[model samples]
Target: MAAAAATNVGNTWINIGIFAAFVAVTLIIVFSVSRQNKTAADFYAGGRNFTGAQNGTAIAGDYLSAASFLGIAGAIAVNGYDGFLYSIGFLVAWLVALLLVAELLRNTGKFTMADVLSFRLKQRPIRMAAALSTLAVVFFYLLAQMAGAGGLVALLLGITDKAGQGLVIAVVGGLMILYVLVGGMKGTTWVQIIKAALLILGAGVMTFWVLANFGFNLSAVMQEAVNMAGENGEAILEPGLQYGASAVSQLDFLSLALALVLGTAGLPHVLMRFYTVPSAKEARRSVVVAIWLIGIFYLFTLVLGYGAAALVGPETILAAPGGQNSAAPLLAFELGGEILLGIIAAVAFATILAVVAGLTITAATSFAHDIYASIIKKGQVAPDGEVRVARWTVVVIGIIAIIGGIFANGQNIAFLVALAFCVAAAANLPTIIYSLFWKRFNTSGALWSIYGGLISTIVLIIFSPVVSGKPADPVTGLSKSMVTDPSIDFHWFPLDNPGIVTIPLAFLLGIVGTFLSKERSHPEKYAEMEVRSLTGAGAEKAVAH
Candidate 1:
């Protein structure tokens, strides 16, 4: 017992040491690049100097949050083949971004999503609408990251209770704020580049180790998972374990897929990355690069997920503090012992830090560039003042995230992230699609799409099973769930996700609102918007630092 205790102590210190090293390196990068971020352009879009490959790497880093690295693996560990559906949805989503949105966004927008929406429409109302939608999506996404950060810290660092989780969250929030305020986009982009490389490397190492354990035979790994899963082994290789086998379940699956596919194009932070490149061609190249990298990374997730089931055991994973979120880290411990586990844990922490920092910068940019500089100051704020407001905005956002994280400590990270995607798809996506493609899309249509989609998503989510209740226990009149309290039993919306209903409603309202309004259509402006969006004619140029 004493020997085992000593070993545990040593492992904890090793993990702490590795985590500190990652933090130190990240801080050094931030301090070094921060000096160059003197102007709003440098702070917001990295002075438009990033190559397609660098921006692609940064995009991959931002997209693969803690939920992707740990939660997806845990879901696979717990639910079998059904968890892999998320992998498919996430990877396919990038194709949508690449084909449809990337180049157009790069050509048309400068700093925020508002810039795109306000291009041919009325500036004030459209900017306000864009700002609201951006903040809404960022809020939910940030909440998920913070909650996941707290839970992962407590689980890996052996913090036993809520107080410890809160402290961990506070520390994470502080670090994220510092990264954004000091480094801006230039600093945040480099941090993301480094984190992305480490994440891919760590996941690749684990995959190779898992494959070697099974003699490099994929079938052997699946067979082992089946065998270890016991009675549920056969089901583990098939669908229905996670979403179930019913009509409603099928609809839910479609909704989730729709949100994951369309949502990527609408994410404000992801969209903002397009502006960091010099031209529409570079944006196109970046998405292609991102597709390959993210595709390969997600493929590795399949191996890691099933490997955890086969090697770590589902029962043991379920018993861990973060449940499915603990699967990848636990697999690391099982495969390579203390040292590998420590390194993997540090990588996971870095993943959370990089992602949260990206989100904060986007949110700050929306507040400063869209709301403060454009709307309130009417584009009159000095460059330095705009950057100052952005930094202060980061502080405010970080505090809100910390408080929200404390309240949302035990929530499922994957589910919260899914909700964010649903909201993004329902609200922001229709606005973007219409603004870019539809000539008759007026300010009223844009407002309706943004406000309609945003409000409807929030309302539907409130009534959805995710918030109100899960299916009741027939015998005990209670739910056996851990994520949400079953106190309010009025969950009339059959689906947990709000995408199916809200997405269509948003599009419908945008069209109907356009027809109902007497606003004049700008045919000449549409022609100009089209030329710029397609060919990058008169698009914003990169300024030298």
Candidate 2:
């Protein structure tokens, strides 16, 4: 109750110490690796020297954000069957990335996702569109990670006031900027690798401990959760508890599923990781290795979620400082008290830091390489100038993230991440798919798809129930909508997620834009891109005009 009451001052300090130690150690690793960043290629893609397994672990680290650890566990603790769907959606997304996007993107792009898109299209406009979309997606993602950090630290340190939580978010953002500015891609990769290992290992330990309490009987664990839930116990095990109440809710779930499954292939950060590995083969292997590790970790979340339900209870979790995000930490406190909570808190912090660093670097690279270098400078900038611009962009992005995270502090991080997935699926996925597989996808079509999807998804989000007009939960007395002011209702969109409408609309816009354009089809360029994408020919060099 009361989010575990900070237990004792000694325990709180211990948690802070553990978290501080992790940041210090990682900072050292970042500085040591910073020396290797001697060129644009080195800073952007880690000199393209990472092996398959190494990149795979880092990819897993990058992919598994605060949403995966803090948010999903909390979601399952509260929503039961509906909550586990996030895990399934996130894990299944990898298949789409692997089968359709990973190897081809790796073989064709040099540093950023825009590289792949601009290969056979008009370089300046296509890169600018791609860069804008990448920045928007990264901004949404960074907000989720930052919000998670705020809630998590507030729960741990018992900082309930909004100002205190806002300060915590700022601190996390500052550290993220530091990591990107000092370490670049190589440093960030190492941090991810380290964080990913710790996260999985911590989750595995907690899962085993939770099951051990039930004599390793998963069914028994579920029964205990059911009994603890009282009147709502049976509903927890059923499908309709969260999403089955109305047709609109069911439609929302479908939209959510589409976003989760299709969004990974278009996520700028995840796509950027492919360029860090050496070749198309390793990029393929990276996805395979990531799948195995990620699958195992999600399995752990199932036990952890139910374990929290049985041990900590949903009321206690929701009452915590972080709301639903407090489930896993509260469970840790319930199981092993001070020590385990400290350890888990540190790992969760690491999760946020690694992910935000990855996102910040991606946004920075896109701005410097695609927008600044390709568009503003007409590709005339020196390597040092580009890297300098990237560092400055990191600072700007980090500051913006801190402010957004402050406003988003108490929201469920997983739900926030789903919104990001919706944006990615709508804004980037259509263009990416058409550019890779459709020979007639010209510059006009790419621009239409990117701008249309990006603008529509964002506009819909602003006018949806997610932004305003949703009533407070009858039981909790809290509104799920971002704008909690009941008098300021302006939402016109009925669904919380606009993916169902926006994703299809984006794809349709791509086709229509292509046909409407009188630009001649570049059959020769398309042929070269096809061969290069499939065979890894000329991949060592970035596509040049």
**Which lDDT tens digits does candidate 1 get at residues 1-545?**
32233224227678888988999998998899778888889999999999999999999999999998897788888888888989888889887788888899889889998998999999999999999999999998999998888778766787767998799889888988888888999889999999999999999999999999999997888899998899858898899987788899889998898888888888988999999999988898899888888989988888999999899788777767667788898889988988988999889889989999999999999999999999999999898999999989999999999999999887766667888898788888898989999999999998888999999888877777776678667866666443234575766788877888898999999999898899999999999999999988999898775
- Where does model 1 exceed 4 Å of error? 1-10, 471-487
- Report, for every candidate in turn, its global Cα lDDT versus the true structure: 0.87, 0.88
State the number of backbone clashes in model 2: 0
Segments in model 2 whose C-alpha atoms lie over 4 Å from true places: 1-10, 473-478, 541-545
What is the alpha-carbon lDDT of model 2 when measured against the actual structure? Answer: 0.88
True-structure lDDT of candidate 1? 0.87
lDDT of 1 at 467: 69
